[model samples]
Structure formats: structure tokens, C-alpha cells
Target: MTETLRKKYRWDRIGLVLGGLAIFSFGLAAWVAPEEEQVGSVLEHPNNAELPESIPALRVQEIQTEKAKEPELDEVVLPCSCNRNVLKLAKNPYSDHRRAARNLPNSFFVKDSNELNAGKRNGKLVEVKDGRGFHISALSHSHAVLLPEVKALLEDLGNDFADLLVGTPSEGTRIRVTSLTRTVKQQNRLGRRNYNAIDEASTHSYGASFDIAFTDRPDNAADCSAPTRAIQQVLSQYQKSKRILVIPELSCMHVTLRP
Candidate 1:
């Protein structure tokens, strides 16, 4: 009976020690555990790893779509002044009106029709033939002739002049060549009608000068004035480019090749 009582006493002591240890372990776990609010929020809202990947792809597609909708602009190439100046080097010098109109050498004068024919045959002169861009005045056609270089210059000018007048109200307008080559005799006859004619030492005799009336129909005010300013603008471009020297005369614009 005494031995049994001692064993029971020892078991009671062991049980007390085990209960104390269990209480200490519960306190430590409670101190280290995360807050319920934080743990519950994390569980409710999972991280979306795929969201970042989709965002960049959507942004790239939006940028590409905007680029495709934008208008394509045409590339405009500007003309180089150096290249144009090089072309102007082919122009003549004495053609400028600033030079003294003194006794020009006999070689410079078209003394008669025979000399004019010689010039034409030798390719020194090009007869001004009426065609698409221009029409020679009836009085001038018979004697219309110019230096080959001058003729080419006029042809190019005429083409550009026509292009400028195109799409305007007076689109089909043609430039008029009122005077071209003039001999001493033709000059004498023209002098009777035109007070501005330079009877002696005229550049016309040299086959390097011509006159352009602003319009073919001088009598029609609607036709003459509409394109006059525009035509002058085109001529001014040529003058500035050094291709020709222009004299804005009362009746017409006198143009001469640069010597």
C-alpha cells in the first residue's frame, strides 16, 4: 500500500511539469505569429504575375497602331544654287543693257539677208520656228532668228512660263514673240512705227536678243493682265538665275542672252 502511494505521487509531479512546458510553448507561438488582418489580406488577394507581361504587349500594339494611322509626307528636294549657277555660265555678257551702245564691230552686225543666211547655215543662228509654247508675230516671223544658245534659252523659258500659267483661269495662253532678228533695213522700217527702237548698235542685229509680249491677246484685258504678273515672276526667276538680262519695256519685256 505504501509503494503504490509513492508511485502515484511521482506521476502527479511529472504531470505538473509537462503542463507548465505546454503553457510556455503556447505563449512563444502567440508572440511570433503574424496579425490576422495581414494574413487574411494576403490570402484574399493573390499576386497577378501575368498582368505586367500583358501591359507591355498592349502598350506596344497601341504605339504601332498610332504609327500606321499617321500620314506619310512627301520628300521635297530643293534645287542647288551651285548647279544652277554653273548652267548660267553659258550666258552671254554684252547682252546686258548696261554696256555702252557704241559703234559695234561690223562682225556683230547683220548687214544684209545674205549674212543672216550664212549664220543659219553655219549653225551659229537658229531660226525661231513657231510651235507649242510660243507663236512668232506675223511681222517678226519672216526675220525671226536667234543665236543657237539664245534659242535654246527661250525654249526652256517658254516651257517653264507655260507651266506656271497652267491650271490658272487663262491656262491655254501662249507667249508672243513680237520682234526677233532685225537687219538695218528691218530696223529702219520698225523704227518708223516704234519710237523706242535703237536704230544703230542694236543687239537684235547680233542674233542674241528678242522681245516677249506679256500675252498673245493684247487687246483682251481679261487675258493680258491676268497672267502678266505671273509671267513677270517667271521671267524674274530667269533673270535672277543669270540666264538672261531683262528690260521691262513699255510695250514688252526685252530679253537678251548673257554674252
Candidate 2:
């Protein structure tokens, strides 16, 4: 009977331990249930091991995107002093261009596109391209061709222009040639579109002239003051020497090679 009673006591202790473990497990489940439900909440995002991205990193990116914006209205852009003192620059008359375009030693009328192409084939009109101090812009209404002598003159002008600006802030600045040789058809089209177009045949139609619209400095390393002055000095020297005829138009500086 004593042995039987001892066996009963051991079983009772085992049952008590099992019951306590069941209660502990139930309490743990109750504590985790609320946390699991709140895992997807916007305001209470809990750390999740299964997430593909770092939770902290994603939050930082979102904050940055929300704060991103365009430039402010009052943001100041420094102005370049290109116009000051450069007003003394020559503004040549257009009538001289008309006279020189027809009478210049190398000038000849390019009546149409066919004549323009023929001039090119016969080596009368040479191909014009970028050189030392000048660059040809995308020509929309003109051919990239000029009289051989005219081309040479242009090259000399470019080289001299570059030399004049050497060691200055506008050292690498280049004059932008906006227009080149234009046929009669192209001239008419331009006349219809542009109010500044010449009333009669343009000097460009004769492959004797080009237009300089802007001087651009690479990298904005310097302001326009140096480039502007350099242009004035170079063009004025050429004009005074009677080597070229010029018309300082509203859009560009029209230049014609003079014999």
C-alpha cells in the first residue's frame, strides 16, 4: 500500500507541471496576437525580418522624396557684363554689303540650288566648316559652301579672332555663324518667315557673306565682357582696313568679303 501511494504522488506532480506549461503557452500566444495584427499598420510599422529592404533605409528615401522640390523663385543668377563699354562697337551700314556682294572680286550670284551645287563641283564654292575661332551652326536655309577666296578670308578672320583673345578669359570663345550660302529659293522662304530678311536678294545668295549671331565661351569660365570687346576690336579693324563689308543687323552681324 505504501508503494502504491508513492506512485500516485509522482503522477500528481507530473500532471501539475504539464498544466503549468499549458497556461504559460496560452499567455505567450495572447501577448503575440496583438503585435502580429499591428505589423502592417502605417503609424506602427514593427521591424519585420521578412522584408526585402531595410526598414530604416526605405523610410529615409521616402522622407527625401517628399522633401524634393524645384528651384526657388528668388534664386539669383549672376548676370554677365557683356554690354558695358562694348557700346563703342561699330554698327556698319547694310548698303555696303549690297555693293560688295555683287562687285567683290570672288563674289558671284548663286541663282538657284543647281548653280550652288555646280559651283561646289567646279571648285568655285569650297566647303565651309568649323575653324579656329568660329563654328558653323546647323544651317537650315543655306548651303555650307563659299567662294574659295571667301573661305580663305573667313579662315584668316577666324585665326586672327582667336589670336586676339589668347590668354584672356574668353580665350576659347568662338563666333557662331548662323547663316551661310543660301539659294534664291531658301532666301524666299526665309523672307516669308523672317521680318528681318532683306527686301532684295541677300548677300548670302551669292555665297559672299555669312552672319555672326553670338560668341559663346566654353564652360562659362568667363563672362561676356572679354569676348564682346574682342569681337568689336577684330571686326572694326577688318572694317577700317576695307577688307570686308559689314551690316550690324538686329539679329546678327552680316559680313561680306571685299576685294
Candidate 3:
């Protein structure tokens, strides 16, 4: 009887152990099955359903563009022989001669009447005398051959009037000439012959070459008016004819056969 009771007790313990194991196994399956389903859903759908529909997806793109700008060029202007101020003086006939004269230095000398007549008659020597007096000391003679042509042109301009005056600097004006003459000889000796120096062979070496200056009249108001007008007219005519070249800065006129 003791042995049989012992065997029955062993069977009862085994049965109880099996029942506890079954309950534990059921709890594990319930927890693990839900988690496995959630993992599968995450793998299938990367975007979460909880995210707002209004939120847009991010985008990237490249754009080409150009900046606005002003035009580089508008119009081209033609070069002219006469400038604006020269045109203005040409139009204003009664401009002030004293003002113009005052602008000139004291060194300027006029060609004398006698020399002027001789140049016109002989058509050879290019000499200009002092405007203050008809003295030979104030005269300058050039060796350029074109002196005759320059003189002829000046004569044509009718600059030989009693009132009109021709003047030159005591030294000389800066200009270019393309001739061989005695004037170039003296200038070369004095080291005054620069690249721009008028060649003795140049037309400017002729006494016919001239620069204008105001008459030394006490009454600046009266004498300057008519003479300035007349001079301007003559200059304008010469410019139009291309007989004389005027450099405004030097206030000197260069006359020649060449343009």
C-alpha cells in the first residue's frame, strides 16, 4: 500500500507541472504575435499613417537665369574740323577782341605792312614783322617753300586791311610743317626744333602763316568789337576752305597748302 501511494503522488506532480507550462506558453504567444504583425506593417509602409496629408514632399531642381542690364552703346558722333566754341565764336560776330588779345601773350608780333606788300608782290619770303612797329628786328623769316601759297591764301582772305593784324610769338608756336627752309635752320641751331617743329620745307615757314591778336587800342570796348567780328569771319571762311588750321589751346593758326 505505501509503494502504490508513492507512485500516485508522482503522477499528480507531473500533471500539475504540465498545466503550468501550458498557461505560460499561451501568454507568450499572445504578446509575440501582435509585435510580429506591427514589425511586418512597418517594413511594408515607410511613411507613417499618423503624418498630416497637407505636408508636401521635399523637392530639388536647378534653374537658369540672366540679370537685366542697360545697353552698352547708343549712338556714334562724327569727328569735325571745327569744335563747339569755335562755332560759337563764328556765330557771335561782335565778340570781344581785347578778351581774345588778353588771352594772347606779349611775345606775339604782327607782320608789317611793307613786308606784307613785299610777300604779296614777290611771293617768296615768309617773314612776319612786329605788330607794335614795322621794325625788321621784330620780324621772323622762315625757310619753308610753301610760304608763297600761305601768303596767297592770307591775301585772298583780305587780311591786308588797315585794321586787321597778323601776329606770331617771339619764340614760335608749336606746329608741324613738312618742308625744308632757313627758318628750320635757325630753329634747329637754337634746339627749338622738336618733332613737332615746323620744317623749313613746310608751308608754315612762309610769312603767309599767321596768328591773330587784338590791336593795342586804349578803348578796348570800341576797337575790339568790329575787328573781332571781322577776324572771326575770316577765320571761319578759312576753316571752311581748309586753308588754315587753328589750334584753340595755343591760340595760334597754322596756314599751309596741305590740309
Candidate 4:
């Protein structure tokens, strides 16, 4: 009986040890298995999943696009008769003639009254009627028959010249008659004959010509104070641009069309 009891006790001890080992193994498996599963699940879903298309950097690219679309400014086209370096005066009708006269060469001066009258008959002189005169002619020359565009331009030039005389700015710069085809007498260097000569087949013949004489003083009437330097600057520019012809002389300029 003693031997049996001892054997039973030994067997009990062995069973306890086996049970403890089984419990430990189960606990380890529960903790480690869950950690492995969590790692696998994280690996399946990447951080970038469900994202939309690639976004562009608008700050840099948009500015570049806008800059490319900007319009260029118009270039200054100088008249051809003057040197290319000269700057063009603004197309202000009131000041254009005065500015033009100031820019014209000294060679262009009005001859004596008789010479001018002779030139008027020979198709060499262009007589531009003032607004008042032009209005009268307009009644006779139907608007449909006349070249409106040319006429408008001449009228604009005339108005501009008148404005210059009155010390106003040219607001409406246009041409009325492009080429009137009149005649005038030109005096020679010696000032002897007043023959019907084409002083200049100028736009002036079309009533587009204007003369700029300087004022002597605030109230003085006879003397002139035309600025030669300023006029030359203008003529130089026109010559370069091929807009008009400039003849430089003592006190006046003979300005006319380029051709």
C-alpha cells in the first residue's frame, strides 16, 4: 500500500508539470500570432491608396502661361523724310502742324504772293480750303463721288495745322483730299521770274500743307521765333520714316509728300 501511494504521488507531480508547460505554450501562441496577423494586414494597405490624380504646381506654371499671353506694344514709326533716329510727334491735329512746321527743314518757305498764285494755276500747287471753304465745296462735290477716306485725312491735317496756329493740341488728325492737283508759281534763287512752276507737288496742294512761322514776342506781329533746332529734329525723324520730304533752307521748310 505504501509503494502504491508513492507511485500515485509521483504521477501527480508529472501531470502538474505537463499542464503548466501546455498553458505557457498556449499563452505565447495567443500573443505572438496576433502580432504577426496585425503586421500582415498593415502590409496589404499602402499609404498612397485611394489618392486622386497628380496635382500640378499652379503658382509657377500659371504665371508662365499668363506672361506668354501678354500683348506687345505698338512700335513708333518715324516719317521717312527725316533721319531714322528722330522721334515721331504725336498725331495731335491741333499741335501736329505746328510741331510739323517746327520739325520741317528751313528750305520750305512760301514764295511771294504772285509766285504762289502762278503755282496755283499750274497743277503744282495744292490749295486746301479751310473748313469753311471745304464745307462750301462739299455741297457741290457729292460725298459719294469723292474719296471719303482721302478727304477725311486732308481735313484732319488742315484742322491740325489750324490748331497749331492757335496753340492747341491736335485732337482730330485726318486727311480731307489726298491730292488736289493744283499749280503754283515758284521764284528762282535770284527772285526774278514768277513762272507757273511746281514748287512741290505736295500734300499741301491737296490742302494738306501747313506753314509754321515763329512769333516774335507775346504781342509782336512781324518777326518770327520759329525754333530751328526743334523743326530739324522733326524733319530728321520724318525723313527716316519715309513719311514726308524735308527741304532745309534759311528760314522755312518746303515740306511735301514722300514721293
* Top of the candidates by lDDT: 2
Q: Using Cα atoms with residue i matched to residue i, what is each candidate's TM-score against the true structure?
A: 0.54, 0.66, 0.33, 0.25
Candidate number achieving the greatest TM-score relative to the actual structure = 2
Per-residue lDDT, model 2, residue 57, is 80
lDDT of 2: 0.76
Q: Which window of ten consecutive residues has the lowest lDDT sum in model 4?
A: 139-148
lDDT of 2 by residue, 1-259 (tens): 8899999998898898988888988988997787777654633443355364686689888877666633432233232222213324465566667777788665678989788878888888889999999888888998889888778878888888899889886787887788889888888889966543555777888788987877777745677777777777888888889888776666677788886
What is every candidate's alpha-carbon RMSD to the true fold? 22.0, 8.8, 23.8, 23.1
Q: Which of candidates 1 and 4 is the stronger one according to TM-score? A: 1
**RMSD of candidate 1 to true structure, Å:** 22.0
Question: Which portions of model 2 miss their true places by more than 4 Å?
Answer: 1-92, 193-196
Residue-by-residue lDDT tens digits, candidate 4, 68-180: 65532122221112121332333323233334433333212333455444544553344445451122123211111112233343354344333443442222221122123
Q: Give me the runs in candidate 1 sitting further than 4 Å from their true place.
A: 1-95, 98-107, 140-142, 217-225
In the range 47-144, model 1's lDDT, one tens digit per residue, is 45566887898999998887766643222212111112112223234434424222222225675799888888887667888755566877653388
For model 4, the stretches where C-alpha displacement exceeds 4 angstroms are 1-226
Better of 2 and 4 by TM-score: 2
The candidate, 3 or 4, that scores higher on TM-score is: 3
Error of 1 at 88 (Å): 23
* Candidate 4 C-alpha RMSD relative to the actual structure: 23.1
> Would you list the clashing residue pairs of candidate 1?
91-258, 92-258, 92-259, 93-258, 93-259
- Rank list by lDDT: 2, 1, 3, 4
lDDT of 2 at 44: 49
lDDT of 4 at 180: 31
